[model samples]
Target: MIRKLKSGQYRIYSRKVDPKTNKRKNLGTFDTLEAAKRHEQEIQYFKHKG
Candidate 1:
């Protein structure tokens, strides 16, 4: 998921909460929402690639 921070940047987080931490994993922080979305797609691609 993507969230807009108070600083106005976009933060990319894992959709699922970490069982150990009980919090969403911090995927990355990006200057733009598009960038965050792109990175999320890349993560999905890598996760699914065999």
Candidate 2:
């Protein structure tokens, strides 16, 4: 998922919340939504490859 921060930056997070922490994992923070989405796709590709 992608979220916009108070600073106007975009953040990428895992689709599911962590069972232990009860929070979504912070994948990355980006200056733009497009950048965050691109990183999210890379993460998905690697995750599925293994």
Candidate 3:
């Protein structure tokens, strides 16, 4: 099983950041862990498609 983030979000590799940033940005807040992974996968798919 994949690791989890907040109950509302995902710890998606794409959404992870170092502790030195000046901003906070998360990919999406999902209703379920499954949904979060799906969102992450979709983003990667489209990102590689372009």
Best by lDDT: 1
- Output the worst ten-in-a-row residue range by lDDT, candidate 3: 1-10
Better of 2 and 3 by TM-score: 2
Can you write out model 3's per-residue Cα lDDT over 1-50, one digit (the tens) per residue? Answer: 23466554545444455477744455556667788778777888897995
Which parts of model 2 are misplaced by more than 4 Å? none
Q: How displaced is residue 14 in candidate 1, in Å? A: 0.7
- Which parts of model 3 have CA positions greater than 4 angstroms off? 1-24
Clashes of each: 0, 0, 0
lDDT of 2 by residue, 18-47 (tens): 999999999899999999989989998999
Model 2 weakest 10-residue run by lDDT: 41-50
TM-score of 1: 0.92
Off by over 4 Å in 1: none
Best by TM-score: 1
Query: Per-residue lDDT tens digits of candidate 1, residues 1-50?
Result: 99999999999889999999999999899999899899989999999999
